[model samples]
Target: MLVSFSPSLLFTRYNSNYSTMESNFQGIVPASDAPTKRKRPTEAEHIPTAPKEPPAPEFLCQDCVKLDLSKAFSVEDTSNETTKMAFAPGRWGYFNAWAVDVGHRYRGTIITNCNLCQMLFNSRVDEGDTKLDGDGDWLRAVSFLEICGLVAYKPHRWISKDIPFLMLFSNKNYDLYENRKKVRHLIQQSGYAALQQLNQQQAIPFSPKVLSPVFDLGTFQNWFDYCNGNHKLLCRSSKSDLYGTHVIDCQDQSITQHEPGMPYVALSYVWGQPQAQKAVNDGKRLPAQLSLLIRDAIAVTQAMGFRYLWVDRYCIDQDTPTAKHEQIRQMDAIYSNAELTIIAAAGQDENYGLPGVGKNRPKTRMEAHIGDVAVVWAPKDPQAAIKSSKWSTRGWTFQEALLSRRRLVFTEQQAYFECNAMNVYESFDIPLDSLHIKDRSKSYEYLRRGVFGGNREAEFGRLNLEKQGPTEVFNRYLSNVEEYSARKLSFAEDSLNAFRGIAQQFWYGKHAIHNIWGMGYQTPPEERTSSFVHSLSWRHTSNCWDLSQSPQRRPQFPSWSWAGWEGEVQYEIIDSKQKSWFDNLIRAVSVENQIDSPTALEMIAPNPDATCIFPVVIFTAAVVPSKLISFNPNAASNKRWQIGKYKANLALSSGSVSESQFAEDIHDSHVWQCVCIGAALKVSFVMILKVDDGSDLWERAGIFAIDCYSHSLEKMMETREYKSFRVR
Candidate 1:
């Protein structure tokens, strides 16, 4: 079972309403314990307004209010109680800090409202006084006071007297002042000692403590040296500067031509808008007029003991289209051969620069003192920041990040280090290693236990997919396609170019697969025909197509190929039981194209012009005229179609296909040709327009599927004779 992981899951928001108790509880205490008598203060006396801030000695207050509920409350009262508790003063500020601390300290420990009130009241009570019980009259009196608004209570629990856990908040809406103060305190106290202690117990190294605003050169140098010596892959690749036109020399800060075998750092950032060019002359020194991002990259490269740095704007001669195209072709090698890739993943554009690099760095750490010991809080994970950054969305940066052997990602919160082997965050003490574990739960447990006893060779062997079967290779390609489709491309034409490197990898590398027009590929020579047909079985996911946006068709690209679209795409899985039935239906497949003509299929590799064109293959499959019966009558407007007894869903193609024809075809069966396309989750078929064009080709209409267990359809499909047609 292959488990899919999303960045959203990694940075899931903390649920504050979660209960720590084994059993659910209603927040309300017994009515019998309610105070029967109360003394009212004189009207003339000034009632203190809700405290502007949480009570001083914040840690004490935060530590005192631990709640443990006894019974679950009715849904109606729970809602009412939650609203009433919102009246608590200063709950979102310092009061929140205490709740967060307690939650982190005792994760999954449930506390009831009665127990929580007793804890808070006890903290304020005299040193020798007994602690109030959950049902105590004193607790009820305090609750009454809180309910009456005479005293403010922090709203920490939901209807169930359970307290929800607090995950670190994004800096967007947090109080920076308090956060900064706490961060400063944490840094001052032995550089996140508490976090370090936790990490040590977990056997994960704590993030290196940075006492200064900027990165420490010495620390970076040590890390660089360590990686160079320990990581074989980092040291194995030969250095080359052929891709870039100019590289900044760290020694004299001069712009110079990239020298082969000289190590350099590549800068990956988003180019937000057209900026003034800082072009370099052959002999003249590099311009000092660099953007903040470029300057920071230079500083980082020099600090990391690298004498050269490659930045696209300065390195590639954008003035010459030929030169730019040539450099673009070497994009994969450029990043892969570099010492390290510096990712500016925090801001939207180049002007934002690298955080903590300049003097005006934003404060990201917070600290609070608990007796003699200090507690610190900072953004626990910088991965969220990196994943959500504008840079991650850009088409060019997608390949840059993936191709790079190692990446030092700078985010708004902190820097993170990633490589093929492991991922480390500046805020985390642990480094996560890559393991081919399909079970998500077990993978997490492995991380928690710091288990590094897995077979290294076996784990690393997974990358060499050539040794594996075609299924593994196909699955990897599909995964890449899934991720690539979700990314944005500035220019729609660059879609194929941006993803071409991955195609090249699958083609020339271990997979040894022949690249198709971003639809299918040729695997083993014997299975080439089947592979081509199977690749066409992709479908548009629910969020893939934006019907409002005008669809642009790339030249030489067929409507069947995903590369023809501008959004995400997913392949329909064929039914395992129906796999043989669908395969047997396809008699042959022959792909053909004009030998000298430029087609979309030719651009399926890293360098399109250099890649060989796949001969146009003629597919011979069982074709039958079938009418589509929509499961929902409103599907015409909704863009959904169903066929056969299984009511398998089908995605309609955009452009040139007539909706009127589809409506007419369902009423009169001869217009729809169900061309069998291999099976995965179900028997897959492509519905082609039956109209005769001057040429021998037929336009793709839509894709549909049928269940293996559909006896009537299977029998009907078996009766049809195999027919051959050319796919343009």
Candidate 2:
């Protein structure tokens, strides 16, 4: 049995009024147990009068009181009662450090007596480790903390016994200061008391300040109002036709048309693989048997004081291909024009309802406290919650999140409100005015400058030419493509469609180019030809190919674009120092679109039945002969190549060239023709090509770069044959 303490005996040292053994006890303990009060020895020193704290309550457990928090207790000190109480065998403790009998008693006392002790014990558990029990089963928890040498306690602010005692556990013998700061940064503070602490001490890291068991709708309303009233970038109305689309009347639970620019909430969630969708047949009432996600979203919309909600499954007419395609095309406007997009980033499928939304809101926040300090185990970083969720991995959800001006993201742990200006979470109780200054270096800021011309702040405008260059926009587009290309798509054909909204957003207005037309090119024909060819320098990630790989190629997309391949692709970032040597060898005279004078909107929203129009680049470039000298199956790009006396690097596009085919090319003495597209520094970027069955059309064999001096390249260019190659 565990050693027990009577409340009556514990209270004897304090005032009779303080009978409560719980955290809220607000009476002073006997002076012997009080923390050494700071002394003002000199009358000359300026003294600031502070509000007198209520009596510091006496702890029921004597073992907890005797702990000298300032000193590090070694594992050998496990024999002491205070040591046993402090380092109880729980989730994070090293079990081997304690004696078997002592650990059993420690566990018993922790589970039964103090909630703070119990919570701290169960705070952090490593993967593959089992829960330590009072019955003497330590499970598979190995002694990793043993290396830290000694555990010490650093006391935090404390007042009423109702407010549990807050103390940081660290190893004074090792890295105690750094560990304390790291732990403090991770813990989420709560209520006005914690906020007061934060206001007083800027050094105290109380990030992600608030987390409650139940989500407050009033808080969300405040955030919504703040974003609507203040965020200028987010407030600008979308250019797309918002009134043409349909939205569900959240109050009526029926699909209805709203007036122009009517505020509606858009739902972005994962449509689980092979799951049955409850679509609105006549664009009227919601289905009687609705998914949990849809039902919860409607409730959330109504609660947030929005009359309309737009969910693709119900809003878009899935049966009518024309209507569906039209809605798909206006995705940029649909999400951007909405008051805010509700991102259901929790759970695997639509069936998994939003946490803390409806009835049976599972309790996610865990609360505990010591004598006068409330305690909570720090939540995992908010970004990890979204990154690991099923919703983040989907292709369709990518554009839905990026295009939105404001996002109300709901994860399993907590809800977050992210706009172009700032991102705030329900876990933080920070004042709205102080949010921008709060250090979020550790937290994930979902706002992207690459999408929709970045943040609302005057200083960070992505389109500001004075602050940022034109190449920065194209570079940002490449970065977006790199991220979007890695995302999973249920249907291979929907790959381009999934990313079209972001493409459309990038192509809109003076922010990028207007004459991009159908090819999804970020630059217009008037821009430097080098900038246009730079978009085509994307190489597949090393993980894209394997020994038994038959890559699923999207034939609808042209070979020059990253969309033609299945896996992730990345662009080689150009250095500013190399601009002097940069040269455009090929001229993109014109992009021959299949349709005559198709607008950017028409190109962005293409017909699903027809193959996407490939923009055939009609250009003249010097074609030089190069041979593959060696190949490495492990290296994704930059395999050695022989170009006369000088060597070069070849990156065979995985969409068309396989390792076996590349090996065969090298063995068979195949002389690959390198079409010089552009030059950067010492190397000349080339498109390795092969004739299509002796036809006039030339398909992209691979992309190569010859490692030679600019003068040497110019020498080679004079002798090389310039051919007018029609590349698709």
Candidate 3:
């Protein structure tokens, strides 16, 4: 349970609910050791009635609060949003530290890198040799001044309780004085830590702030009521502790019913998000999942003898508050009751295929025509010729790679059913002092104990780690496939380089005028300053010496735009003629943030009332069979697309095609930049794709295609997955 402290009690007191929590909010001023008066930025003497700041977060550690100084660096933070510029490496690097009155101590940090942080924390923890409940929660308290940056790991003890008071930062730099002052001022305010903690637990971390109306999760008259609160249970007095794990015995109105199903098994799919998400083919593949990921959840459950499975979408109403809370709170039970949590581990190929995480693989249509592929001929006889057709399948996708590997662990409550499913392992058995397959005689003893329930451990033993190590198999298969891909990429890169050379020369040939087609070129101020017409004798040289638009057209170099380069500004390019001749004509058009490019096909997590619109342009003029994209929306939006199983892609020409839609389904662990070239293309973004309104259009992202110039590959990453993936 979480307890809030009051500012009036001073930094030393740890109490609940300070009455003066909101009294006279003060600016965060640094704690001064010297008595001489100094003007701190937070002093009321500087800015009197500044707008009230959000509640200050308290440091979340017992060591910090008790001034132990030893146990520090207890911060829990969420990964950076992919839409944010900070998430470049496709992962989040959290910095956790412990702040105190004396010196700063960083307890630990968790990330792909920064192993030192974890190593340090673990070392400190091991030195004490104190055992903790494996969940990592040991009640600890911290104050505002005692902490800095986002808490890397909130004390597990506070879940469902008041959020452990916390402090977070926008960037890596932490200004001690400013941070200390902010902490001091908030500590002086009553209930700042408490209320903020209270608010944090009731909401999703890092999500937008929205006050949803409370909902009533009541029973309906239907056979489906089997899973909901029974009439007798619902009739129980509100004081009754009716709902425990999965049963919703109505405690009545005091506790708002969030969803119709108060307690039910949630058999939703969990997408396996590897820490590194590495595969053998990823050029520099780091760490990878070596397992069999179940791509079909429904199929897996039915395979386990369960007839009806209750998934969140089919069992609850997401749009309602009652539904959300009931489900969110019931998450613990839903999974516990679930027969199994099937993870999608389908690969791009049945056996050997690299994942589809990088840029889209664009192949020209003509490159696929392999003539050696022959079909049996039909004979004009009584017997019809055997149906003769030869077809080739496209290469695998990253999304399929994503779908192919996952881990499923049964909670204590669901452990009993391990054997009920098709899994190859089991746990909670008897000791194995002399247990070995070689000791065939031990099998009878183990079986005796397992059946008699005499010594579950000594008999059944823990889950056999050795049974069916398929993930290793997956990795091995990937190794062979990656080698093939590497060779293919080498060939493709050569072709691409050749095409690029041709394209550049044809578009900007040696004799090509510099300014006529600089529409997409963004010249810096230094270049523009020189080009600016300042000679006062006449007019703007660019306007006066503009070349006729007719001369700009080329027989071979056609632009993607149908709009002629009219209404565009002309720049002066000094040629052999002493008098400057304006040849470089450019347009000043706004560039879309590139939010809806292929990178966002369906890999987005959004707040309610938010929709991510991705505008993708498939180059119909270019190659390969057909392009397929995977649209895996984040968990909030459970969307599905039906393209049937496309064995082969249709020959595409630039005809109108509907933008396929899939709601966000699983949570995505990585974020990358979406780059687009054209500044002339108009774009709109929304948090959700709906009929009349947009959830939110985020224009804050400062993304651009020009940044790619700094990147080595100078290419944007893009890929798609089919909607047929049964896993949500």
Best by TM-score: 2
The C-alpha TM-scores of every prediction are 0.63, 0.65, 0.17
lDDT per residue (tens digit) for residues 340-359 in model 3: 33322223222211111011
Candidate 2, TM-score vs. the true structure? 0.65
lDDT of 3: 0.21
Write the residue-wise lDDT of candidate 1 on 1-728 in tens digits: 01222222211222232222111111111111222332211122121442322223223334433322111111112235546433232222222223122222222233322222222222221122254222222111111111211112323321112111122222213443434434332232322222112122323233333222333333344344445555554234534446445676655656787767677789999985775655565554655455667766765665454668888877777777787778787777787788788999877899887875633235433333333322334353454466567887777787788777777888775667765544455554333332213321112212211101111112222332344455556655665676676577777777777877666656665556565666546555665555656667666553214455434445455555667666556654322211222253466555455564433332333334543354344566766545435545465544455554455555555433444445455444334466765665445455454433576655554566555433445565546666766555
Work out candidate 1's RMSD over C-alphas.
17.3
Please list the C-alpha lDDT of all candidates, in the order they appear: 0.48, 0.52, 0.21
Q: Give the alpha carbon lDDT tens digit for every residue of 1-728 in model 2.
A: 01122223222222222222122121112112222442211111111341122112232245444333212112333557664544432223333333212233234323333333433344322222265443442211122122111112211220010111122222112232334333333332211111112123333222333244334555676666666666545345565666457888765667887568577888999885444545444447665656767767765665565678888887887777887888888898898788788888888888886765533233333443233333343454455467677888788888898888778887876777766665666665545654332332111221222222332222132333223445555555666677777788877788788887877766644546322312334344445355656665565654224534323467676666677766766665553311323466774444456566423322343332332554555567776643424455565544435555556665665433455566555433134455767766676666766555565666665665667754576576456677776656
Root mean square deviation (Cα) for candidate 3: 33.0
